[model samples]
Target: QQQVKQSPQSLIVQKGGIPIINCAYENTAFDYFPWYQQFPGKGPALLIAIRPDVSEKKEGRFTISFNKSAKQFSLHIMDSQPGDSATYFCAASNSGYSTLTFGKGTMLLVSP
Candidate 1:
């Protein structure tokens, strides 16, 4: 597993808006970058991810923008909604391991 770190601990955004969260990793060997969305009283599930070779990746209202050169990446939540209010975690890991190193955590509050 790689040591990944994220910031802002929490975020507040308006409904139908976008909220951006940043993360950085120290290991250059890490090849997998994944973002996870977690609701209250639940475990985090995969949201989006990008490999080191890719500059950006998106799925639905979730997007993962990666900067391999900078060993950094971020998650962008588009059209944020009250239902989207939850904790987001940016994670990284190398091959051969199922374990992920997550950041402290970010709680996103989408106000209706």
Candidate 2:
């Protein structure tokens, strides 16, 4: 099975500090990169994503940095808040394929 490895099992940051989560994969066929955020009682939700054609993508306080050649990507939350505390996951898949490989989640705590 394809795998995506994530770093820093957990993280703690100040209210406004940026929390970055990294993920690396080995599959060159994987072209879609997405980040998901999950809260206590809710299922994971798509936060942001980027394609291999782009180097970076930003949406509001969330950003995704992609390195196509390295087959890696990362998610960054800028000006994090207590409400942002949750588990973040990175995933990769080929658009034409039905399989999606996800990395182990990173639990983030944003201090108030």
Candidate 3:
């Protein structure tokens, strides 16, 4: 199992609304869960991550909810804003090389 899949190719959120994206994987061997945020024409930067040992992880307006048993995970964006409109990617990897297997990507558009 070495694949992580994400859905909702794109999303739209109001300035103060919350946007949620879903992801699922088949690999139980994966230990690192990382969500990356990317602006137009830029590389994605690590937003937040959680290990399999943790059930959930949160940072600033970004939160990652994980379910080890189901091999599923999700990203929640709180207080979504125009500046937050960007491409978000979900990735997973085992404890070895930091080579991340990334999702297709989800484009989030936060409007005023």
lDDT of 1 by residue, 1-108 (tens): 457789889899899999999999998878898888898888899888888887989899888889888888999888888999999998888897777788989999
Query: What's each prediction's TM-score?
Result: 0.93, 0.96, 0.94
Per-residue CA lDDT of candidate 3, range 1-112, in tens? Answer: 4788999999988899999998899877789889999999898998999998888888898989999999999999889889999999999988865778999999999999
Score each candidate by Cα lDDT: 0.88, 0.93, 0.91
Q: How does model 1 fare in lDDT?
A: 0.88
User: CA lDDT of 10 in candidate 2?
Assistant: 99
Model 2 has an lDDT value of: 0.93
Residue runs of model 2 more than 4 Å from their true location after superposition: none
Winning candidate number (TM-score):
2
Answer with 1 or 3, whichever has the higher lDDT: 3
Task: Looking at model 2, report the run of 10 residues with the lowest lDDT sum.
Answer: 94-103
Models sorted by TM-score, best on top: 2, 3, 1
lDDT of 3: 0.91
RMSD score of candidate 1 (Å): 1.5
- Tell me how many clashing residue pairs each candidate has: 0, 0, 0
